[model samples]
Target chain A: MDGITRLVYGIYPRSDELRVLISRTERGKAVTGDLRDRISRETEDLLSTFRGSSDIYSEPCVNWHDFFRPVAGFLTGFSLGKLQRYLQTNTFYREPVIESDLSLRDRFTEIDPPENLPAPLFGNDKEAWLTLPSPHSIFQASKNPSGIDEEKFSDSIFRAYAEIATELGRKGIVLRELFPYSDRAPDFLGALNGKFKTILVAHPESRSLPATGRNHKFHSIVASNQLLARAADSYEVPGIYALDGYNTKLEDAENISRKSEIAREILSVPRVVVTSNQHFDFLPRVIADRKLAVLKSLGAS
Target chain B: MTGGLVTQEIGSFRKPEYLSTVFRKGGDDVRKLIERATLETLGVFRDSGLVNVGVGGEMFRWEMYEHLADHLEGIQFYGFVRSFDNRYFRKGSVVSKIIRKSSAHLEELQFVASHATEKIKVPITGAYTMTDWSFNEHYPDRHELALDYADVVHEEILDLKSEWQKIGRDQVLEIQIDEPAATTNPSEMDILRDTVERSIEGIQGCEFTIHVCYSTDYGILYKALADTALQGYNLEFANRDTLLPGINREQRTGYVDVKEFADRLGDRILGLGVTDVHIDDVEGSDLIKDRIEFSTRFQDIGRIRINPDCGLRTRSRETGFRKLKNMVEAGKAFTDRT
Candidate 1:
């Protein structure tokens, strides 16, 4: 857990103009190869602007504008839920319902990096990571919360994740960032213990860290600072403190540095990854950029 | 409180798939689709025999918050943001001038009010939810931000009222303010109370109902809101069914706490959620009646209205319609006996 302080940037935010463009394109006919290229290039252009930010800790989630679209195929009876304006921080996806046993309906091949996202944005020579909804998240987030056969559901979700992780790994993706929205990360991670390499568990919600098992093999845990504050002793692995929140105000760099420093002290860990508790997509690009610059400065301090 | 147990929708009916596509094009097709969708929804509610009918917020393809945000200024629709709870927002704000009122809502309300032989209720996202749900970039405090939103809502309600009069619609309809984010940050209860109160203020001649879900701690906020001009409280009860013998509390089941809400706020008309929106299997009318009967243990039967726990947009049109039909049947059966 020592000597491993990596600044991570999970996903990139799209501008309103780009969102309209994407919406129009999505509502239009099937995304042609040309249109896909255009959207990807435009998305890359949006991301390239952030390449100069020294503290842009993580790889740009170039194609993650629709967070759940990639995993939409895993659920048998997948229906998109309405755009959650308030709770989702104002982003929308089909509230996916996993009605039956999970299966790899799609080849799980499209889960890899798009060819258009420039390699330099992939952290130059550094190892780049990819993010996906965890099996637990898919199950917990689904409509069928009860009557889910835990062992069977776990197996199915594990298989789907393993297949996707393997495919991403084959593409030389170094880390697979799995978002475990459930409080059962310890159980879920333990199930995937020896299956994948460099798996990072990031919980978007501010949930208490689960009790650690002896076989807990997740590389790192990313969660809310509040959750970490409540259950820091429960975590056996190094934790990345998500410092920004729904109301995380724009403060001066000094104030941000102080808060970052306090979070570090509270965790009492030598290695700390400063990141937003949720995606910074909620803020305007200017504010998000400013916040990132401050976070980068905090990382430097 | 009324002649029979009132039946209403919590808001948001599923639009036909092609209608969603056509409505986005926005022209003659959009108007036709709105009318068709509105009629289809009204027909479903009317067939269900529901007296306190919803206009079936079919115009909203997105959820309540974003749909309202789309019509207002200062809100920039950011692309998809997904979380564990699957609740995301269009990255925007309530910070700007809300020039665009929800005239589309009033249009739908007018259609329902004119056509349907039942009391039409118009549901809108509440100010506290609009403030609580959005990223508050402009306001110095959430309380002030929520009040700003309240002012906007108040203005919209006034506009809606004006529109309602222009069409000669009923003056005594219901306006439901949905505050799904009310309990998201429970520490802001006073702010939420003030926001709700102010949102419904100055808009006279209609009944105001506040709908908050997923939390029983609404007692605190409900008490504060009760001090205002609020007339009714619509809350989720069936989704949180306590009738289940041994279900865990956290698994989105059981209504024991709803009883608490009912006990605390029983003087007001209570719109009880008798259908669980998350499940696909339509609940039988007997079960719905049982849930209503269970509620009668706490509150007066006449004061109770039946609705699904939340919007039916998440379900298929088939499933949503069937559930509403069952719910209406249950409401009628329960009223018949009572």
Candidate 2:
């Protein structure tokens, strides 16, 4: 048994100081250099506190407007649309509007590993990774006026994303699918799993597995703790169970322990990562930090 | 109907800076400040020519959830969580059996009852939202938690009714159950229907309306609330609408739901959102008239009402005032032309 491993994902909540600075910068009052340093300061605190304690992680994407927003830079045909509610939560994300057929941006096309991609916060730590909305999710949420081919668009997204992460020289990529998938989503995800160490963070109830790919399995799958608590389920993948990401009420230690025990029994593989279900952006910084502290304590059980 | 197109305030306005300061840092003069702010906002409403002034701009409360949860027992807030619009609100977790510790809107209504010259519509947070926003730590299931919250809403409504009775038994008391979270989650649709129905059970001497804001798919809610006891639906549209001014379908795509709303629940009132609340640029009176005229294709002129997409708390006091004044002017202009 690989026992238990802890992981982190998504943007950390911006500090109130940083929020004020962002407001200032938006109002044309603050300098860019100070804002960058202020943004890094919070992540430095997190990394120093628990750098290697968590096995697989995504750097705090506090600067990105939303999950799919940065992906616009990697593609040729999309721009940020209106802010949409992120699934059922109070959090909102800017929907990408595809005015024309999406193709890999010239940088992603010409450069083998684009040297221009943003530097990873965790550097070359093998467990550190980058995440974006799954191609299926992007396809579903985006407004495609030109009626792009689903399969072709999905291909470009996976190729460009894989190139970006491989060049960033990080471990892998996380494909986050919080909403219900389009019927063809499973097939699109299958193609993405063929490259580099890949992990899929889907809804707790989603039963999508790698449909057809060169790599038959993801390194692991992280899902809501609800998956393991269910009375009946048949899942072939090793699971990283997680607690609610949005709620501020601290999860009970006893209950998390119980769910991990259940995870061991239910998952197919021995390696089971435990973590928070979604990004901490929905929560206050202090509460999310406490929750992460709880996550860190679940090492190598 | 009521002889003219009616104008209403959605819920909270930008509380005057002085009152907002008191609300932020509590002081002995908090009540007095709220009363003064309410009276001041009422004067603004009177000048704007509104038919229904919503508790003189909901001045007694800081926000919907924070204000309502503050009055409820068995709910404890942990810390502030970021809202969809980049603001933060203190979301509570239900720890024990939930009950109404006091009325969220009784005093606001009482003050308005004493002073308001215009018809008053009281906006209370609905059960679905109260349950949806709270962490369900104590309940066995979400439905049970929602039902208990319905009890809390029911009690608050009863309390308001008694106050309304004290002032005017012969007059109709208007209740706007604000459910911004009503259609946000489709899984909770059944609970939303059940809770709205449960909240108004055995209640009388009132005209009930539901105000749902920024819902992703309002079609689901038009169907969901079809079985509820609500008599009106105040939905947000202008927030997503194109800004062009015309009385045709192409120029008025946001009013598409008005047709479905009329087809499904024609008898119920449709509180059409004729202005966007997030932007400070006031919609022209002609734009608001075009929006209203578009809805008249499906719903009758008498059954229609107009308001901002949601609360005006996001806008500055001046911006909010202009938006309201434009809405009232457009409604009057439309009625006069008809």
Winning model by DockQ = 2
Give the CAPRI rating of model 1: incorrect
Candidate 2 residue pairs in backbone clash: none
For model 1 chain A, give the 10-residue run with minimal summed lDDT: A113-122
| Interface RMS deviation of candidate 1 | 6.1
- Error at A88, model 2, angstroms: 2.2
DockQ of each: 0.16, 0.37
For residue B296, model 1's alpha carbon misses the true position, in angstroms, by: 1.5
